[model samples]
Target: MDSFEQLIGKNINEVDLNESKTFFIALLEYDTKHCGKRYPSSKYKLADMDYYDLISFSQLFKKEAILIVWYNMDIITDLEIYYLSNDFDILFNDYYIIKKAIDNGLAHKLTEGDTKYLGASRLNEKVPQPHSDILANKREFVLKKKYLQKIIDEISFSCK
Candidate 1:
């Protein structure tokens, strides 16, 4: 699969792109609901995005059918895709990480013990560890509450 940038540029048609004001407006509503901020759009600055910005971008990218997989030390670390059936607006889909890894060639399932699936978005942490409360034993991927809350808090604080 192509990168988010490549996917959006290649997959979204010219007519859709031109008529996409509504799509972007819907995306804004989606972002506000999910990440508490409107996405910033500029072709030049994609490479410099921060975490929350990337979260915002991911929603729009997923809406355009882009699949984002963030890997950490060969674990199927983070997966982001929109649930289009529920709403025209975007929503996150959590996956059975172990199954996803095995299916996607990221890792093999272990018979016992916790399988660590670290977050690739550890912006400042010195070491990567379990970043979510969702049991690793369940083999599912979820963003950690504290990490997500911190981003939301920063968005709240900065906009104040």
Candidate 2:
């Protein structure tokens, strides 16, 4: 569906998970929009998993649409989780959203339901360096702020 770039813009620098220590895990469960035909991927399997593995596994299975994990980046990025899976080679994380629905609350509320693990991704690893995460977070916050201001200006002009 929507790439992070489309939703949040590419103004934010992609964090180097290999270096950052604060990590967030986004668990994903794809909704089946078609009739029959099970996907080549599993819904909720938690084994030693990591960001890169998510990237690789998605490429292999090609069934999962979005990788949904928790938004706790301060704790889960340094892990190479796929090492624990029976077939770690089949995981991937393309077009994933790092932010959580909790950030959206209300209409965009994060369901902390039991179905979370069922369609949720686990954030079990952390970025190796917290400093890296800090930089990424700052960049994202600033970019969003600027985007909001631009939208406000456009609306004001239209009303005038």
Candidate 3:
């Protein structure tokens, strides 16, 4: 199986979201028992090492389809798939600002509070940023947690 990073330039439809979700869930389950004490700081025993790559890849599509896997006490509980129409005028503007900031060497300064919907979030301190001239931590665009919660709330409300 190709790493999520390898799927960056591919069309969104070409990547099987269900397969990826299944793989991650299995990985988490296995890692929970065997990889004890490996990640002391993580609330969940397992962390997807490719999460930043996955989010970056998702941003390339106009219709960003994300699979949200819910967990309770480290056990998989539910899964919800949501699509963000990135081509909307406001979303496009936000994306453009984020891209411009990165291209302008401000990636290191980007914070989650910088945008209402989307944000450029730091991935790792040592990861090298390709677009910035200044040496900076690698960053990936992500939907703000608050914004994600709002979406989840709406979905939950509608389902009732």
Candidate 4:
């Protein structure tokens, strides 16, 4: 038997990417809902993105499909595609609470955990520890929530 990771497409679901593809992403500090119905077409300075600016960006960028798994360590956000150049209007887009942290910075250490999966350590401080409320409420978000937000596939994006 092969490991799931080794299994050809067994564990793979929606994400689609390749080593040669032009990968671009932003490490945004926000919730899934923050990815609005409209995406930011303007150029963003990835190194220094302000929360307010992000708020504006969020209001515009509605690409994340829906909530898949919103947890402490794996909060997937928006997944979108645009031209590599400054022309942001050209969008090859799809929406899903993405699970990849992407980058285009120069001379930066890139790794699996570094640019994939959303980290909610900042919320842990505020959220009640040993969260009894959450444990008690665990019946699958689908059952409790109005809909079991479906998984979507992006023709242009992929996650490893």
TM-score, structure 2 vs. true:
0.18
lDDT of 3 by residue, 1-160 (tens): 5543343455322434434422222111112224331111111111221222333323344344555554334444456665555334555666667666665656667666766766666666545444555656655555555555554455543321
Where does candidate 3 clash, by residue pair? Answer: none
lDDT of each: 0.28, 0.25, 0.46, 0.23
What is residue 80's positional error in candidate 3, in angstroms? 2.3
- Give the per-residue lDDT digits (tens) of candidate 4, residues 1-160: 5543344343333233322234423322222333332222212221222221222223333333322222212333454443233312221121012111111221112221222122111111222112122211111001111011211222222233
Per-residue C-alpha lDDT of model 2 across residues 1-160, encoded as one tens digit per residue: 5553444444223322222232223232122225522121223332222222232333323332222221122222122222112222212211122222212222122122312112233333333222122211111111122222232233232221
What's model 4's TM-score? 0.18
Q: What TM-score would each prediction reach against the true structure? A: 0.18, 0.18, 0.51, 0.18
Estimate, for each residue in 51-112, the C-alpha lDDT of model 1 and write its tens digit: 21223324333434322333222233334442233422212222233334333433322221
Top TM-score: which candidate number? 3
- Candidates 2 and 3, the one with greater lDDT: 3
RMSD of each: 18.3, 20.7, 10.8, 17.3
